[model samples]
Target chain A: MSDLQIKDAVKSYGNVDVLHNINLDIESGEFVVLVGPSGCGKSTLLRMISGLEDISGGEMFIDGELVNDVDAAKRGIAMVFQSYALFPHMTVAENMGFSLKLAKAHKSEINEKVRRAAEILQLEKLLERKPSQLSGGQKQRVAIGRAIVRNPKVFLFDEPLSNLDAELRIEMRAELIQLHKQLKTTMIYVTHDQVEAMTLADKMVVLEGGQVQQVGKPLELYDDPSNMFVAGFVGTPRMNFLPAEVVDVSNTTSTLRFAAENGAPEVVLPMTDGKLAIGSKVSVGIRPDHLHFSPAQSGDLAIPIDVAFVEELGDLTYVYVDTKAGTRLSSQKKDGRHNHGTTGYAVADTTSMFIFDADGHRVRA
Target chain B: MTDAIASPSALASNRRKIKVPSLWTVLKWIAAISVAVVALFPLWWMFSVVFAEAGVPVAVNPRLYPTSFTDGFAKIWEVFEETGYLRAYYVSIMYTILTIAGVLLISSMAAFEFALFDFPGKNALFAVVMLSLMVPLAVTLIPTYLLVAQLGWVNTMQGLVVPGLASAFGLFMMTQFMQSIPKETLEAGRLEGANHFQLYWYIALPLSKNALITLAILTFMKTWGNFIWPLVVSNTREVYTVSQVINQFNSPFSHTTVDVVMTANFLAAIPPILFFVFFQRWIIEGVQMSGSKG
Candidate 1:
């Protein structure tokens, strides 16, 4: 059985639903990330699991026990907040041991536990300093230490690294992975950043508009996203979408063609999945890395585009172009032949692109 | 000169700084000193009268320095012999301490609940507290006195302290300060196994140190110097606070001794003055530091 299970969990404010029918099973010692854009209900779902929010409907189970009605403190779960939330007047050791102290544990036990956690986080020397005296990174370490001392079954991190500088955030990400490996505990982290989600999580749950769009391993989601939103939201220099239509259908095979604005020679690609009607509107999504320059006279499909600008990074280059279909697409290429203020053709291999139906659901199974 | 309308006084001050002794500067200094002297003259005059020897007429020109300093100590001795001077100090100190304890407990607890919790009727209840501030203390005096008498607390310390404990203004100030603390801090405490009272006692109270100190000073000073409540409640020498005994020296059975009255008054003002002198920094800096980000 999974260590934590959320079965048909729903959360709603007065009259409006934030998350509906959420079903998730977090295995023991798995690092899961709930990734979404702002207002996508990832934080709300994490809060519900933490018992900080009331689940409007459905049930939550932790370690095979129903915890929907349990108080947050008794739920045996620990969370690290984005703001650090260390008590200003308390020393770092006291803040870390506060939970054990409130439990009326023996003084020696509390000190030992706090010391162990401090050693893990390398905060033993700063035990006597108050939260106000510590730098931002140290404060963050103390917050994590506060959770670590609890030895909780599952750890919840609500964008714990969002407040740090970029370099520190990256450093802390590696530290957190090390922490997870050492503890061997189930951890659920919430973030709006796909890059952090991709780097940190063992599994990713993509959410949009309060609904879980997809859940899989990070690279699995990156390679084969279920739909348009996940496909676009998961990658950097995001996927490019162009309009396409089903031209003809035969037994177990169908031909599709692009709907370019300007009349241009096109290659009709045939697929084995014959689940398409003739002349149906569809969207074609292809990653910029998949696009390649073909011979001038011939390619799978030639896209007439106006080159707007080119970004020349030392290792790579991004060519931004406006298509004849009036869609702005950026292509990633390592060769930095950046012609300023010039028009160029953007070519693509048709079979590499994903085709979506009118409902934005993938059609090429 | 470039921004003439924006800072004409600044420009004038710059021009005046050019090694010039002008008549207006001397007159400005005179006006400022006059205001300061006017504000502080009563305390100086009280000391002067208290120090003057018994039945010796005060100087015609009110003096800033006391004419005879040792007589003030002698007059205080005489007043203590005649009236309940020592007993008055005891009553006043106890009354002030109890009053501060009661008010701070009630107000801070109420303020914490108001700041942290969501319940029905919270806003309406706070509004009622605010509305009660508009009612003058005099209007409630008779009813309060009757209630105290009915409770068999007449001439008791309770009558002097309890009725003035739940101050509306103190509750309002405390609640505003409590609200300024970040909500995440309270939530952290809650998740750390703290109940409502624990949250208030441990988290809210510790974080609100500055506001609590300022409140303690204000409430202590106000209760120590109170006159009307203790006057109406305590009818005998055993229960008289310092301020009540000071009132007794005004006439003392038809023979008015102005010097004794001044001496008693001077003695009574010492505790509150010393309190303010030591803690005046908290009263000002507390307000400034409150709600500021770390």
Candidate 2:
């Protein structure tokens, strides 16, 4: 295992920059995941770390040694691609031991390493099978096993679970977590799936427009997003954003009212910093889970809504409703009693509400 | 008893419906058969002339089938002894083998780079290569012959094999095929410490097996029947390809009978026929894939 440092890394094609000044420090044995939407340079950043793509600018170090010019093989990095990328003509054992064979290791040693990797991945019975004969999940296991047998300092996964079915993806995700624990190798994974990022990452890096948006522990980013983008992107069903204007500001609290009409829902949040001025426009960000059908306590803002739909998943139901101003929002309910086309109030908890200013930066105390 | 009788009638109706072909389907089959017959008639005529007795006027008789198969065998032996047909056969086989090997390797490597890599002027360079295909081979024949003579490759196997090795058609087809290989597969090889050449050899080549085989068959057929180039280069029988030796039977000074000429042509056509018979499936598959991809 090795620590990797990318310092002010910039990747550009001709005059257009794809990734800009990306600075990340991945500690040894840490499972770091870079999560973002498509074309956000997450895969590009992973390729740079693996030395498959040129850095274009800035420096990279592996194990505290400068390796900006090192070849991917020489960098001691192995990558598992989204496509599985197993050689179609190669057997499972050959695919696993390809790196060792390329390095000209002795045949017995290659076989031993391949055997160990296969055992770890539960692929012993498939050692002689070609990739074409394997199921999607088995192919992915072989891809991961290929990386494992390399004994590389770091393992890079470029959305390795993206190709599997949902059930298999979850199964593989759990297996990946177990693999991380068992091997304790420094691994950097890239995925557009936030659930995968939240579950698999020890340190989650949220990226947008080629720049790092937030980097922290999974729950830290989930509960305390640095920007509106992270607040919206880090959660399922996405966080709801309502246009609001600061109606009143005090030394210790700021009151915001949603919708321009009078008697709209209003909430007061603790803000000792006095950053908001009266009549200043801001967005109220609330997660689906944080919105409740019944207010737990007084002082929660209750917004009147027309129920658009309800998605029931056994113990919980997601109530999707449209506010009077026509902004759609989703509220999670444990009682699961909500129905379509019903008029009711969904309470937004004051303590859980996040306020972002006109620029989409989080408003903090 | 009434239900059983109704069942037989229903089954008979269904069978009658299935057995009758639509007029459009019949027309398609008729058109296809007409084309097949038109394409195969020349071959039938060649075989008929080869099997007819020596000095027999096949054009006058217009026989659709062979009259005497032994007559063709006797004429083949006569031609083989008199014209050193075996030597020409050896030359053609060697030329085809070398040229196919060279073409597949060179074109596949070139296609691998063209399809997968990015460098300055890549599109422009590929455009130039494709543009060369537009220029007729006959247009470049004189200059190419001059160059070959300057290099002292004329009258040699290299002269026959090397000029056509960098086949634009092969490269184009292989590039289209190679482009369909998933990029992640190559990158995986790169990460596994395989160099570009190793990736081409181990991954790209295997994945392109169908395209390679298609190109080999095409090159085999073309080089086996190659006439103009061998005629221009080979002044002696030592380097004469099968096509050139067959051309010897048609020369005005040779006084060779029509049956001997047709027999020589029949012998030259056998290898390509067998090659096609074996690998026709891959040829069709390669053509379909290249068509869709390109």
Best by TM-score: 1
Candidate 1 global CA lDDT score? 0.84
Model 1: CA > 4 A from native: A262-267, A293-298, A336-341, B1-33, B57-64, B67-69, B286-294
* lDDT of candidate 1 over B1-294, digit per residue (tens): 385475888888888888766899999999999999997787777877887765564546555566676887878788888887898899999999999899889989989988778889999999999999899887998999999999999999988888988988778878988998888888888788888888888899998887888777778767887889989999989999998887776754847567777788889888877886888787567547543210
Backbone collision count in every prediction? 0, 0
On DockQ, the leading prediction is: 2
- TM-scores for the candidates: 0.92, 0.91
Model 1, position B78, has a per-residue lDDT of 83
What DockQ does every candidate get? Answer: 0.63, 0.76
> Candidate 2: where is the Cα deviation over 4 Å?
A247-249, A257-259, A265-267, A294-298, A339-341, B1-72, B286-294
- Candidate 2's residue-wise lDDT over A108-143, tens digit each? 999999999999999999999999999999999999
- Chain A TM-score values, per prediction: 0.95, 0.96
